[model samples]
Target: MFETIFTAANRALVAGLLAGVFLIVFANVVGRYGFGVSLAWIEEAARHMMILGAFCGAGLALREGRLVAITALPDHLPAGARIALRWIIVAVMFAFMAVLLWLGLKFVAFGWDKETMSTGISRGIPYMAIPLGCAIFLVHLALFARRFVVQEFEFHAEDTPSDRQV
Candidate 1:
């Protein structure tokens, strides 16, 4: 139940952010070229939205096995070796994300006093994407770690072999 909710919420958030960014950018472009007016804040808003969307979507990408990876070595390795390599990779990802989350928090704290030039919102608001993304990524990694290790890459939750068989 928790997993379903979390995944759904994460997907919604990412989709919303991306959609907002798209609409804003489209409007900005049309306004600039067609109407000969450009809102200064539009660029800043779009940039921040893109950052948030990319970061937030990362976990979903990982969970769906959409993240870019070089699978040549893992693909050629024996079953046990492939599994062992996956475990090592998972450990590295955990450590990397943990450090990123910590650093992101520190960065947010540092930016709390600062504000964006055009939007005038606290810079921490945008800086927050890092830690939030890392946390989400960590949760996803934890939830899917077993499947990732065992399956060695093809682990889309809805498209699993059992589901297909049924």
Candidate 2:
């Protein structure tokens, strides 16, 4: 289940999206100046890819335990206390994911009829990334929760597997 979402394929998708953004933007710049012509759809594609990349990258970061932390409370807490803190963190993530998923779906529905300026793609296509990202986050959190219990409060950044390719 969660393994499906946290696969190397997703890592490749992120890499592809990032590459697409860079190439499109670069071509757009070259066309605008070097050739004095630019494709109208290029900007939209780049923007959408960037948005998707950002969301997917965020999920990857969350899954790998790479999100920035304050460490204010965790620094002072004991091992037992840290487990309680992590539980609280998971609860907060669940709540946040629920609301974001709901709003993202509504947003997708609302934009179903709307199309992009250049490609005429339904806005819902890109907007769908919202819920997709949340879904990824939910799966990640679930995996973390499982490990969180089995590891006996032993949640360390080093213990989380990363999908990054060096």
Candidate 3:
């Protein structure tokens, strides 16, 4: 349930970010050629949208296995070795996400007293995305690791002649 909600939010964030970019470009073009009235808020809004988009999309990327990996070595390894290496990579990723969650929360706590100049939104609101996204990414990573391990184990088991049927 939580994963579904977060995934939806991630998708929405990406769509919003793309829309913001399109609006900014369209506004600029219209202002330059048609109205001679440029929008000052478009750039600021676009910047904020970009940040939110990147953070929000990160969790979804982890869930979908879309992030880049150095697969050259893993690809050459034997089956068991490859599975072990993959597990190691997941462990490292989990550690990184933990650090990110801690630091991101600290950042938000420190900035909670501040407010944005134009929007008047609490600065902490935007900063909260860091920790929130990282936490979600951590959950997604753990689930992914569990699935990988389970699948590999099952595959190996099934490959055995005693476990197979002709």
> Best lDDT goes to which candidate?
1
* Most accurate candidate by TM-score: 1
**Pairs in clash, predicted candidate 2:** none
The residue-by-residue lDDT of candidate 1 on 1-166, one tens digit each, is 8878998999999999988988999999999999999999999999998998888888888766777778899989998998899899999999999999999999999999999999999999999999999999999899889877775443455675653311
Quote the positional error of residue 156 for candidate 2 in Å: 15
Per-residue C-alpha lDDT of model 3 across residues 60-133, encoded as one tens digit per residue:
66554456656678779898897888788788888988998899999998888998776667788878878877
lDDT of candidates 1 onward, in order: 0.87, 0.76, 0.71
Candidates, ranked, lDDT: 1, 2, 3
lDDT of 2 by residue, 30-99 (tens): 9999999999999889888988887777656765545665667876889789778878877888899879
lDDT of 1 at 56: 88
- TM-score of each candidate? 0.88, 0.81, 0.72
Off by over 4 Å in 2: 1-5, 146-166
On TM-score, the stronger of 1 and 2 is: 1
Q: Is candidate 1 or candidate 3 better by lDDT?
A: 1
What TM-score does candidate 2 reach? 0.81
